[model samples]
Target: MSPRRSVADTLETRQRILERSLAIASAEGLEGLTIGRLADELGMSKAGLLGHFGTKEGLQLAVVDEAAAVFSREVPERVKQAPSGLRHLRAVCEAWVSYLEREVLPGGCFFTAATTEFDGRDGRVRDALAGMNALWRRDLRIHIRRAMSFGELPGDTDVDQLIYEIVGIMLALNHFLQLEHDAAAPARARKAIRRLLGG
Candidate 1:
């Protein structure tokens, strides 16, 4: 193969590995990932897999990054055209619930699974998950503050508290859908959000 063809092939292979890793991690948790298992599942040799990511930790980190990209594409990116303030906030939240309702990941929310899997741990993986979650919270805060400025929300609203409650709704929605398989979970979450926002 030409040099350009070789480089393209390498990129394609890496993408394949990351895609498989995301699916497996979503369903089984990042801790459940193993080089041997991935190699066997993908029909790639252990050496070849290792070549893509020198260590298991490296692979896990890459998977976390990929998961973040997927979340951005599915949630926030979907609402980019919505006007900021309460309208954007509502659009983003609805997109988030829809992402989970559609079962974008086989295990439901990838971050929820990762958070539960690594919340108690200390390492790069845990730190990466925390950082991603923090960024998400920050976006919510911006929208909440903007809504306040527009008088859509009470000026006295505690932004952090509101964010906490909103996040709670999503967490509960994930739990209900994943554990109890509740079909009404999404509607319940949307209703609760609307009530909280005083709509």
Candidate 2:
């Protein structure tokens, strides 16, 4: 009979592998994430790593899922206390910028990395990433709608456009910070969002 690995032990190992993979990817990009590299970093054998995740794609998917959970937990809480409107909008942008500015994903954002990495590729990864992007858009739109309802924005505002602009602002801030960590992109993003909302 095979020796049994406790469920808790299995989960801890999986979490470590996922976190290590994210750290590697964040530092070296997605292409740098390999079972061999992960095994080496984790002080485990390749076979042991493969026992946890059967393939590279499997590990990538798990990392994405973990990133998603982190995003969900971190982003919304920052804005929860703000009144719904320009403040809420600003808070959301600030929160997103903070999330990246702090390097929560180690690689900036796994979504940004995956989208840039696998956008043209045809497969499960691309599809899953596309869905995640869609979900983000939806969530941002909901906040925009709320802000609009609060009369914090122009009644003619388009949620779709606002969401895209906010995302662009985040991307701009991310790279700007990456290039010059001394530069305050989050504050700039807040300023730009204020101007956009006519605040």
Candidate 3:
């Protein structure tokens, strides 16, 4: 007879499935995830997997939510523990490159890959990514403003332009690391950030 699973076991099984799905989705875009593919990969039947997520969109949404949680834990949560304002902002930028360095997502930054995949598509997937992007931007800007409050940056700093530059550097860093497999991408990013911060 098959072994019986307790409530905790069932929950753990679901989490395991989601984690594996996250890894796959990290490498393959969400569109690459399908019920049949996941079911086969997880050794579960299509109907059994669909029991967890009613449809492909539902599964994609869950994966996006999980990705956001991972990013928050790895990036923003760690940044928050640093000194506030510009220090936090600096950490914010550094933590991102660090994330890519560690290959937290097998395909590089999940959001970066997702953005490229969904930027022009309109749907719940796009909404979810847009929401996460907005949250990151808000956090970055708040830190920059706080740094100004702490006199770390000039009072006249063009907040928008500064954020633009930081984000641009981060995008380039990801490209260098993911596309070119450059070992110095993170260091180059830090150097750029230091120059931008005037220190």
Scored by lDDT, the top model is 1
* lDDT tens digits by residue: candidate 1, 1-199: 8999999999999999999999989989998889999999999999999899899999999999999999999999999999989999999999999999999889888899999999999999999999999999999999999999999989999999999999999999999999999999999999999998855
**Candidate 2 lDDT, 22-109, residue by residue in tens:** 7776656667887777888889999989888788888777777777778877787767898776777677777787788788866677
Candidate 3 lDDT trough over 10 residues, lowest sum: 1-10
Better candidate number, 1 or 2, judged by TM-score: 1
List model 3 lDDT by residue over 63-129, tens digit each: 8999999989888888778888777787777888788889988888788888899999999999999
Comparing 1 with 2 on lDDT, the higher-scoring candidate is 1
| Among all candidates shown, the one with the greatest TM-score | 1
TM-score per candidate = 0.97, 0.88, 0.92
Q: Candidate 3 local accuracy as lDDT?
A: 0.86
105: Cα error in model 2, Å: 3.1
TM-score of 3: 0.92
lDDT of 3 at 41: 86
CA lDDT of every candidate: 0.94, 0.77, 0.86
C-alpha-based local distance difference test score of model 1: 0.94
